[model samples]
Target: MKASYSEFVELGGQRYHVRRWGNPQAPTLFMLHGWMDISATFQFVVDALAREWNIIAPDWPGFGLSAWSPGGYSLLQYTTDLDRLLDHYSPHAAVPIVAHSMGANISNIYISARPQRVSHFVNIEGYAPVPEFFEGSLGQVVGRWLDHIAKPGQGRPYADYARLCERLQQSNKRLPPERAKFLASQLGVMGDDGLVHIAADPLTRFFAPISLHREQLIELWRGMSLPVLCIRGGRSFISKAFEHRQEDLQERIAALPQGREALLEDGTHNLHHEHPEQVAQLIEALLEQ
Candidate 1:
């Protein structure tokens, strides 16, 4: 795969590894993966969609093969960088945006706030405001205190590459052994401690003090006029405390100015990876709209 891939490109002094698949004349679809995930997350879907749209996927800094920023990395920085990439590449406009998890959040902000730069959007299992999701339940809060007393950020890392593979397989119960193996391989790196540490930066695993306000995201949605296809996993949280009800969201989505939605029958937070066939169908439908 790397043999067929283009070399990493440097932009703004940081290297970003990007890969494009499919026809040059076709419409472009920019894929964004969730936090801690690499561009490999879209390998299967990108291959399938490549025959139609030019699919471009880049590894977010600090997560995949891309170079991380000097200090802590933040989503705001990603949005600014994304805007530059869009200005440079999608200047002609009408670029379709497809994203999952944190990627979904970034794309949502970009398209909603700057519709002139984007054509359409497909968000899968995007995060929404929860009064308690970030705050935590009283019981969970107590549990956290207990956890802190026991050990602070001391969970054991993977024992070995094989163990890492096993852990990924177990967590992603929907994945086949081969698929899990492929994903696990991308995230494993030799660490100084002689272990295959997961590619995720530990600093990013915890919540940062700064983030866009929930109300602000809602405002973006309200002002958004571009076509939107918001798909949520039926099993996913509408809030950290509530699951999205598909039958209910159908009407709610229809009521939104220019939005439509579907609930994936077999999907998780990583809906695109977990249910690529359904997600691809949604993307095709959105493109037609």
Candidate 2:
């Protein structure tokens, strides 16, 4: 399959790498990948799309080919960087967004806080990283941060490129051998020792001190009047997590003025990767609507 090529751009005092497909003049569709995932992870989904679009997928700061923040990661920092990126790419109009996992979590908070920035949002297996998900108190959070800062950051090196691809497939049963190999090619780089290391900052493994309060996210949801399509993998752990708070999750989804939800019967957390054609069909319908 044909794939998008990458280019680097400086934003927010950091360099960001983006994978682009289709025509630049076409309507922009911003794609956000999950934690530890690079921009190229969306290649399959982009290929499956039936409509013409300018798909821009950027590697989050510290991930993929993007530069890392001098300071550690935080939701506010990530959201701020996203705002800067939008200001550069889609200044005048609200843009459509497709986000997965951590990317979805970041965009959810952003759109809710700045509803005027997004026209439509497709959240894939990511809702919000609300405080409810945190088991640590302020003291624990501080201790974790201290520990992380005290330790030297290091990326995990693989025995070889094939081993890296194999590891990816082993972790996600839904990921095919071919797709895993593609991702490995995009994400792995050769180290001086001839080992393959993931092309992302090791600092990303550090934990954030806090997350948005669940009530705050709910407030954003109340003001989110734009259309939303929330897709969940029937076999995804994220789906099960939401089920633990079914009443709250349903209420939030219900609050969207034009909200809808779907389930890929055989899908996992990486539904877009496993069922790109189906996801593309849904996206086409979403954009048309």
Candidate 3:
């Protein structure tokens, strides 16, 4: 395994934790993680690469070792944060982005909003937000927010590292024991009090009060100026809400100025981790195109 290093970068008054691997002079590849996941979650995938890439993976605010957002998180904030991240790293050129889940969602919008900032993107199992949530009544949304504000958030503590690993495995059945153990270490640290807990801010559990409409999001997809490769996991529940709307999802994907979608056999939502070699091959193909 290649040695990776961790460092902090102050962005917009918040300190971000970034994980890096490979040669700094190599072409930059931004690897973005899903909700509740840290930059190190891409370890297996990064290790399976065939060529060198200066991999820059940041633990998004409120996740991993990054500082929490004092004003709470919004989707727009993620896009701007990424914009600043790129400015600080690749100040003069567009770079490739490989993102999963929530990270993919943010990248999709970012590329749409600022097409010149990205050369291409590979989105894994980040089909689209559930239509229901996007269509929810404003009153209901506010009620949920009020409820969240009524109680202070708290992180769940684990008795030991092994216990946390077991829980991680239970949550993602496709995750092997060794990978789970590795991810457990990446997700949290053992506190001096002798308990293990997730590094993400507890308030991250709060739901967003508003979301883009279905067509509004599709417009963003349509505006993408770069080629995009969308990967789906055959057995992942991430697309469960789109089970009956596969056509809509495909249409949205097709709206990309240049887009291609593929589904991997026997892969789950975390397919990048479960079959990093295969995922790496797909990414290589995208790069070739």
TM-score for all predictions? 0.83, 0.94, 0.95
Model 2: ten consecutive residues of lowest lDDT: 127-136
Tens digit of lDDT per residue, candidate 1, span 53-91? Answer: 667788877777777553556667788777766765677
Off by over 4 Å in 1: 1-4, 136-156, 244-255
Candidate RMSDs in order = 4.4, 1.8, 1.6
The C-alpha stretches of model 3 lying farther than 4 A from their native spots are 133-136
Residue pairs clashing, model 3 = none
Off by more than 4 A, model 2: 130-132
lDDT of all predictions: 0.69, 0.83, 0.84
**Better model by TM-score, 1 or 3?**
3
Residue 173 lDDT in model 2? 80
Best by lDDT: 3
Against the hidden true structure, what lDDT does model 1 obtain?
Answer: 0.69
lDDT of 2 by residue, 1-289 (tens): 6557789889757888888899999999999988888888888988898878999899999888889875678777889878988888899989999999888888888997778889988988777653245567778877887788667378679999999999989888878888889889988988899999998777787746676666777677677788888888888786777766788877777877788889897898888778988888888788887
